[model samples]
Target: MSVPAWLARGVFRVQEAAMRRPTFAMLAELERTQWLSRSEMLDYQTGHLNVLLQLALAHSPWHADRLQAAGLADAVRAGAVLPSDLPRLPTMDKRDARDNVERLVWRGVPGGVFPYTTGGSSGEPLIFYFGRARQAADAAGRLRARRWWGVNPGEREVYLWGAPVELNKTDRIKSLRDRLVNQLLLNAFEMSPVRMDDYLQAIRTWNPRAIYGYASSLALLAAHAEARGIRPRLDALRVVSSTGEPLFPHQRELIERVFGVPVSVEYGARDAGLMALQAPDGSLLQMSETHLVEVLDAAGNPAEEGEAVITSLVSAAQPFIRYRTGDVVRRSGRADPGGRGLAVLDAVVGRQTDFIVAADGRIMHALAVIYVLRAIPGVGQFKLIQHAVDRLEVQVVPDARWNDAAREAILHGLRARLGATLVVDLNLLDTIAPEASGKHRYVVSHVPLHGALAQAVA
Candidate 1:
């Protein structure tokens, strides 16, 4: 059973204190900063940028060299770096973060650094470290965004997320922690027919004020509920927040129709941090206090729409200044209708990963298989193609860590998810080629979901 909102809030605060995270403190600051005017917002971002650059200069030798080569080393040291000076430095990519992590990371940052992995739907598995400041910023930013939709912290939020893994002890502990914080985690990784039915019932019983999850995963669950003639009584649900992938128009319509609440899109990357989130006014607003997002074309020139390169102000544990996110986004060039000074994003053309169908007819999120590859060390840039129900192929650009054990781990992990009868073809390559369309996708599946499930998604 879910705890009362007041009790949840108290429990959350106590836990945050124990973890030494300034979550609520940061949230309080963000709550006030959200009202800054456009120029004022820029000033806020610039001040934070200066601090981050100084941190990188002092602790991160790799970034220090880059700053010096960009001719801004002295300026950064003097705490006089401006927003315009950002362009002087070259952009860093996922490979740079992976290969030069030791040089990029600041192990001595206050509050400590913790390692995290994300294969992101982009198929690039990245292992990055973040400190409590970043952790607090992400949490606070989401809290600020949720307030825009009339949903406050500790108000019974349901996460159709991927946290509940196959491991038993870890799963139980996570489940318990989620409850104390007044959050429910329905496994987005499993999502079989039976499990989805239980999810529908759980959401109804919990009566959460907000539902947050992957866009496609939420759509799939909504479709399942509709097919089974289950219209959940979710009067308390203020918004259904979609993240992980782009919320296509059709998916939005379906989710809104099924949930009886408006659907909101949340755009962010695991490596780049949270960039923007949709407000009640329907504009995607950047986290002005924590992130500075740039839309640059393929040639690296500023554009109305192109790739998103972010400078995370709070990421002092590992500075990500001018880091290329590989996400295609268009700048709105419009002011916030809600009267906030936050910058807007017109659209985010996020990469889509197709669903994988197990041999036993279980529908799994692409992350299900992606996790198999991400957990195994030595696998570099990789791609997974599901050619049929029982057949799958994984192409990997192996790094120095690739070995006999890593190869065996790949086979064992994939089989564990796709079923033991699965036929796995593992291809090790020096480079992963883009698709025939000159676009790169990390996961592709030729097999389609049959019957009502297919129709709901279609």
Candidate 2:
């Protein structure tokens, strides 16, 4: 027996309503408006900080004890403190926060409802919760950023991402709805030259106003197209936004030069909403209105600019108070004295876990591999796995036109960077799979952490 059409519609409506609650709508609208003015932005940050403090005091047993231990319970009770005062509070790790998520909500209110599990790409997975307000803020923040790149909710968007949607799952319904709402989803796992040629044809036919996808996937497509001499007139595309991985200067230039559009780079994680975006002028601007970001040193004092620790000002359900993000960053400058009071993040190195240590004690960022290999034509998805201190495995999914020259160029580049003593292995495959959380890790390292690599500034 088949289910009734009305029942299916009813179920979809319920899910959509749950995803777009009034509280979320209000928070999203507030976030949107806050970015318009410097004063308004400061007020939003202050308000979020106040909300977080209340949540922290009520739900976070760890934070509450730390506050009391520091003898600042009264100061917190008095009123909202400045950013400078925030560092004096105790630091909370992911495990500590995850273990006490239930206690972090407002008293008597069941802490915002939805529970999420973090992907263990950085070693261990974390389970946490977020109130409806925070969930809505995230969804809305994503929508807002899409708008900045000229993508609307109902427009057709070609997604060049790593994760493939299961057609047989319940998510298939949502995928269908997404298409009905005018979204075109593409699989990043299929990056062969033939597949990319089909994708280029689809772009010409669909004429999508915007392209949103992973940087590595898009870069591969551009490189493949360039080699094949198949230049599709993508003039209909207004913006191409790349996320999930860092976009190097060379990669950005290649995409822009081939596709004939601006490539907007964004930085974010599953735990937080949008963290930063490339401004029209090409500067990386942190989303200060909704998040409080800090770069800190080993002493726990602010670093001039190093590893980024973030506090979610807008999340009351799961208060990420000074949560370490495990990504290295450079601070642009101090918060504007007479401006929005939002901190500036200059750049983000890949995951802290992926920094490869060479035999000569030189630290190599993941981008070094990405920059060297992505320039080669017919190379699709790729991953660099470090097996030993000086041994590395480079995996690639090549297109039909791939050759030994491309492989040689990659090995030569690695040899130049890591010295002739470094042993490099090239592994070719049909495809490189993305992680469960729908993100691709370009670099993987088994090296254990020894010293702190992040520095922060006040």
Candidate 3:
């Protein structure tokens, strides 16, 4: 049964209050702060950053030492730390976060810290602690972003996402909770032809206001619907929000064509919290009110395009100060074209798996190798699989331009990025297969940050 929008909204607000999350309150604040001028936004970020720093100094011993060593401890104490001074402290990666978690967490923080785990999509699972504030920020941020597309809280939303194990008590409870909040969940993990047909039917009946799911998963469903000539009747749908992976151009076009709605890209990680969302004007706007994002080159200097390091202001329970996110992105110097004060990002290139590691330990984005093959006229469609640090497998579906020269160019280009000592196995095929999980990745690296997390989180 469908819940009334107003009643569902009231239930959700009450639930958040019962859990002491302050979610709706934060949402109200975000709606206002998003319009602050650039200079004013910086001041807001600085103030929040200092408060998070103060919490770290008083509780998280690991972060306290780093702050003192960076020579910003006194300034932080004096509440004078600027966003620019953040570079003095070294960046922390997944390994540092995993190993030093005990000292980094403030278990006694207000509202209490709760244990959480990353999805381990990068093959590196991290167990960390987060407080209620982080929870509120993520929830409120998503609600605010959806509002940009005319999706209000409690409006019916369909989630094409992973679900808990089926036929369990927890699954039953989750299903009931989802309906109470006016959401319908379709399993992205189980997407056989028969299952997809049922999902399409269910979506037609639900008639949600918005849809959200992984970029690849959404594209797969959209392609299936298009191929079967079975478009769901979605008169109320305002937008289709894509997350998890980078939404390529072809995927966006296919999804928009099938769904008859604009595709909005949501950029975030489980550990990084909600970072940015694509606005209606086609610009990716940052969650500048709660995050301090810095784009830095390989040498750790600021650049227009490089790795993304973020500081989550609301993460006082376990401050992610100067946390290195392995994903590469380009910085947009332009302000939000939609008249918002939030900073913009040009693109989210890819994550760690999207980059290949050479035999000599050099890491470079997959585009380094892709540029080589794309320049070859013979290659039609291709997939690069890095089996090991020194070994790679290239699967190519050739076109009329296929030739010995094209083959040689593919080898030369791969070797250029992955060192000449690297071994390349090139295969010509009719088609490249999708992953078992139904997602498509141009580059798949088996060994990313090799042996980074040797043990499970205890």
Candidate 4:
């Protein structure tokens, strides 16, 4: 190996060991746990769940009240609370997390707490606190999942993602860090044809072991590449990891055909942390190491297809015990077809956000508009439908917090991100109905990206 390549890997190893905030310890542990018996894995998870429960009871007022109300507080304190007994706790929604951030946060966490907000893809934005251990778990879980496909840490890979605008500074530093890790990033927010061509060339030159990106963006890139006959001969690319949205069968086929690699679907929300990743055997296995996911029907019964309620085991800084994720998922009690000990999820039927074309010719993820509405407090539920490149229709169901200032805030927010030339129409509604499929999408764009995506972000 080249000296620098070896040096970077060595440095990362030292950092992993020395770093208390987020070490690679969990990644090492995952190697053996994946093959453990299902009962054994549950036992392991139950151990962590008990600790989290005790911590939440002592530190978090929100969880303490709920646990007490459920009459499980004393049991939890007496160390008799089992993981199976978790569902007894009442479920919390986005608003609960938002309104109770202070009460939920364990401000005295050792590594301190990291405050952040969701981009509002789930119809509302929430400010939550996550500690370093939670951060470490997410990173390590991903690394272990990558190893399932023979891709190791620091291997050459490409990230086609766009963080929220406020994370620009962090993104810049991350870009530099990515380079050190032999990773390249191609912005998904600005996917002009010219930029995509550059990305294709970069991917070919980089010869990455895998490609990771949004399902739709990758599919669109594949479509554009196929249309223009710009397929790069990537000999080392082993897999295409798709996240941020659902991977439709057709999109998967197109991506596989163009990239000549299997598409692995990763399902989770930022608020909940990394929940599950697709296994090599094609099973969507929940990260049983740090997450306890429950699938419940509308009436709150355990069903085949229903809302995904997640209890993040690592949510000690701010417990999300029995949190209603508002995502539709089907889970299998049957062992993972992959023969892994991780629990299997039949599917994560979550929000299908569209690609919005900005008036200035930028192609943005629906989360961009979701950011506008979610950031406004008075806006309860909203949908932004883009009918044309220059027009956006916003349907908002105002809440008690709604005021005249909120209306102006929405307009200003949209104008700032989408550009001034775009015409935005606001409509107040009592409720926003889901589609025939019974899926509620906060944002949908009818305008095609055929030529619109040809213009990269300026």
Which candidate tops TM-score? 1
Best by lDDT: 1
The sequence of per-residue lDDT tens digits that candidate 3 reaches over residues 226-314 is: 76887777999999999877888877888898899999999998788999999999999999988999999989999999889999999
Per-model tally of clashing residue pairs: 0, 11, 1, 1
lDDT tens digits, residues 208-298, model 2? 7778777766766676667777777866687888887677777777788778889988888767656887655556767676688888866
Candidate 3 ranges with C-alpha deviation above 4 Å:
119-121, 163-172, 352-458
Candidate 2: stretches off by over 4 Å: 1-32, 35-40, 98-112, 162-172, 334-343, 352-458
Q: Write the per-residue lDDT of candidate 4 for residues 67-151, one digit (tens) a residue.
A: 8899998888787877779778778888899888888999998788887767555466677889888888888888888988988
Stretches of candidate 1 off by over 4 Å are: 164-173, 455-458
Candidate 3 TM-score, true structure as reference: 0.77
Report lDDT per candidate: 0.87, 0.64, 0.81, 0.81
User: Looking at candidate 2, what is the lDDT of residue 421?
Assistant: 80
- CA error at residue 372 for candidate 1, angstroms: 1.1
What's the C-alpha lDDT at position 7 in model 1? 87
- Which parts of model 4 are misplaced by more than 4 Å? 1-5, 11-20, 165-167, 170-175, 376-378, 398-409, 451-458
Alpha-carbon deviation at 275 in model 4, angstroms: 1.0
